[model samples]
Target: MLVSEVMLQQTPVTRVLPIWQEWMDRWPTPAALAAEPAGEAVRAWGRLGYPRRALRLYAAAAAITADHDGVVPDSFDGLLTLPGVGTYTAAAVAAFAYGRRATVVDTNIRRVQARVISGSALPAPTLSAAEMRLAAALLPEEGAQSAKWNAAVMELGALVCTARAPKCGNCPIRSECAWLAAGQPAPSYVAKGQPWAGTDRQVRGAVMGVLRATRMPIQRELFFAPVPELGDDGLDGTTFSESLRSQLRRLHSLMAPESQLERAIEGLLQDGLAQSREGGLLLPD
Candidate 1:
């Protein structure tokens, strides 16, 4: 779960659930994931935005297998040592899996903390020592109960105390919330948002999606391959050739910068998401 959290940062939960299930089912144990080729791990990552997380997860799996006998470590320090396991993930795993009392602060938790404790719409750029101290002060004395409380607070922020428009009336903590008491002061900080369309990231994602959806390797030439020779098209070869060229142009526009796309393609081949075989591109079995 902790590993999944790290991979899923800034990604939508709807997309993360299926990937997480597929990953855990295939690996099941850390040792199982460790035994697979690193390339296989990358291929399994599919269209998750950050490809590097796949590599980190593979490394973390290996560390768990070699050092901890495949059991995910229970201590905060131990979890922190795993690749891609940051402070948030380490604390979350320790609290949730090991029943330790720790403040698991993510965006959701930060929102709740900011609104209720500080009467703000959002928090500082990063979690600070003061924020940690304040959160820790609120943790329940019992370890197990503290974990449950932490989860509850985060869940509330996700479902109700949303960043855009919090439903103050139904909030369990509304009566005591500083922000609510102060009439929900306006957000002091602007939310950082990234555009989606026409970005290289989007194009890269589309390329990966195409690879994953295919059963056989696609040809590098066929990337814009003439519509799979549509059975006896009434239009004939001349018209088809013109259409193919147009389609290729459109696809080229949608892909990454020429050099970047070439590199991404090469990386995919190296990672086993793609393979070059006898003048064709293919997904590995």
Candidate 2:
């Protein structure tokens, strides 16, 4: 439950399914993962977007193995002390895993609360104090029932009361929904989309991809080399280095400007997902 909660954060269930299954298959227990190099965990993360989560999970596993005898802590406060476990994650693990009555207010749950109780299209960007209080108040006094309710409300938001194109007709609480009662209004604030094509995240993924694909460290220049422009006539099929050209072209599509690439690499290093060695880059050791 702890691993699933961590992986499900900002990541879709479809993408996480196979990876999570493989991960559990490989490391069925915290002690198993704790015994492996942290780099292996990052390598196994396999394009989940946030590679730092892998490092944090590795750290958490080690902590659990060393400090808690390989058992995930059942209490929210104790889970919060683990690396990468925040308020939502701690509450989620406590409620979902241990059947503790915790206020597990994830984005989905917050959205449901906003529309159903507050007559809003969306909740505030950050979890507000008032929202926290409301979530706590909504939780059932019984631990098991509160856990079940938490899962149900979150699933409702994800499936029926989605942020965009909500299936209000299919919503079980449509009749009593505050937003529906108030004549459903659009959100006052616009939600910004994360830039990808030309952003640092794309470049970071490219860099990590190269690192993960190769066994030895690759030179910085080759990793960030600019794509050579091809004329409208296109490449000659008779060229001797056609395969090499194709590889470079593919690499070029992934490459960002030198400065952006360097910044992205530095960020990865700071996040402990990548390492800089002698003039080359590699995954963390």
Candidate 3:
């Protein structure tokens, strides 16, 4: 479950379920996953957004095999000591796997808690120590049932009290919800997101899609082929340079004009996907 939770980071659970099952089927235990090549894991990742989580999971599995005898740690501190494990993962494993009374808060749990308990329409951007303490307070008294309670709250938040359009009338906790009691206060902050269409992220996803789907890197021209459509919707000849600038241009042309395409490219470089050498853009091995 820890492995699935980490893999599901920034991803919808519905999308991660099949991939998670496939991974566990292929590598039933930590020792089995540890023996496989990290590249194989990344290949199996299949467009789950942040690809590095695949690598991190590989590393964590190997670490567990080497240091912990292939067992997922039972303690929150022990889980936290593992690679890629954080507060949420640690608490989640403790609560769900070990049946500890730890407070487990994800986006769903957080939003539900904020709206139902805190009387806020939305949660703070990030979890705080005080918020954790508050979540701990809401845990059912029985340690054995704590995990079920946590899961129930999170499920309620995800299915009924969703961010965009909450169905308060159908909510199981609607009667006790603080926000509903307060007449459904308006959200305080603006919903923020980079538009998907014609954005650098879209181009990057396209580029990564092309690269990951194939065994080898493709030529620069293959990506920057001319498009009949004008504006950011189409790739133009000017973006076909074999240089880094052209690589950036191809992504920029696809992205919204306001997007930070250059910075996103730099992030890819830092992650070792695209490299600049001999005045040409190339994918890393």
Candidate 4:
């Protein structure tokens, strides 16, 4: 449950499924995972996007093995103490894994809550105290029933009451949906997709990609990948052949500025995702 929750965060299920199965097969128990080096977890993360979650999971495993006798915590508070666990994750683990009643709100549940109770097209960008109180109050009194309620509401939002192109006719609570009664007003704020192309995240991921491909320390220049010094006779682009220009563009696309590369490596070192090794860089051991 912990692994699935962590893997599912901001990642599509199709992308997470196989890697998750591999992880479970490799480390069925917290102690089993804890026995491996932290770098192994990052190596096995395999394009899950946020590799930090891998390190956090590794840390969480070590914590569980050391502090909880190698068992995943059963209580919401106990789960919250895990390295990457937050309020929603804690409540989700308690409710879904242990069948304990909790205010298990996530994006889907929040969306459902907004449309059903608040008569809004969407929930706020961040979770609010009012949303928390409402979710808590809406939970069923019985633990098992509340757990089911959480799953049902979240699934409804995911499948039928989706943020875009909701299947209103299929929604079980369509008649009671406040947003429907209010004539399905548009969201007050515009939704935006996260930027990705050429961002620091791309540079960082590219650097990590190279590091993940090998166990050996990587020379820093590989990331900076500076173009060979154009000498005094430096042929300008206009003087170069078409093929040369094409190759130059391809090479340029693979390189980052020295400053950005340094910043990325420094940030990785600070995050414990990387370490200096023999005058080069490598993932943490």
Question: Which of the two candidates, 1 or 4, achieves a greater TM-score against the reference?
Answer: 4
- Model 2 RMSD in angstroms: 4.8
Expressed as tens digits, the lDDT of each residue in 1-285 for candidate 3 is 887888777889889999998988899998998887665777678778877677778888988999998899899888988877888888888998889888898888889988988999999876788788888888999988998999898888889999989999899878999999999999888778669876556766656554555444344544554433323322334332234334444444574333344455566667655655544344443
Stretches of candidate 1 off by over 4 Å are 210-256, 260-285
TM-score, per-candidate, Cα-based: 0.77, 0.90, 0.78, 0.90
Q: TM-score rank, highest first? A: 2, 4, 3, 1
Give per-residue CA lDDT, model 2, range 94-148, as digits (tens).
9988999999989999999999999999999888999999999998899999999
* Model 4 C-alpha lDDT per residue in residues 1-285, reported as the tens digit of each score: 999999998888889999999999999999999999899999999779899999999999999999999999999999999998999889989999999998898999999999999999999998999999999999999999999999999899889999999999988889999999999999999878789876677777877776776676755544554556432222332243343334333434757667776787788898999988977788888
Instruction: Please provide the root mean square deviation of candidate 1 (C-alpha atoms, Å).
Output: 5.5
lDDT of each: 0.75, 0.85, 0.74, 0.84
Candidate 4's C-alpha runs over 4 A off are 227-254
Model 1 pairs whose backbones collide: 217-281, 217-282, 218-281, 219-281, 222-225
* Candidate 1 residue lDDT tens string, 1-285: 766776668887888888889988898888898888675776788767776678778889999999998899999889999988988889888988889987788888888999999999888877888888888888899999999988998899999999787898899878899988898789887878789776656655555655554444445654443444433322223222444344334556574566666766777766655667666565553
Worst 10 residues of 1 by lDDT: 231-240
Model with the higher TM-score, candidate 1 or 2:
2
Q: Model 3 — which ten-residue stretch has the worst lDDT?
A: 233-242
Clashes of each: 5, 0, 4, 0
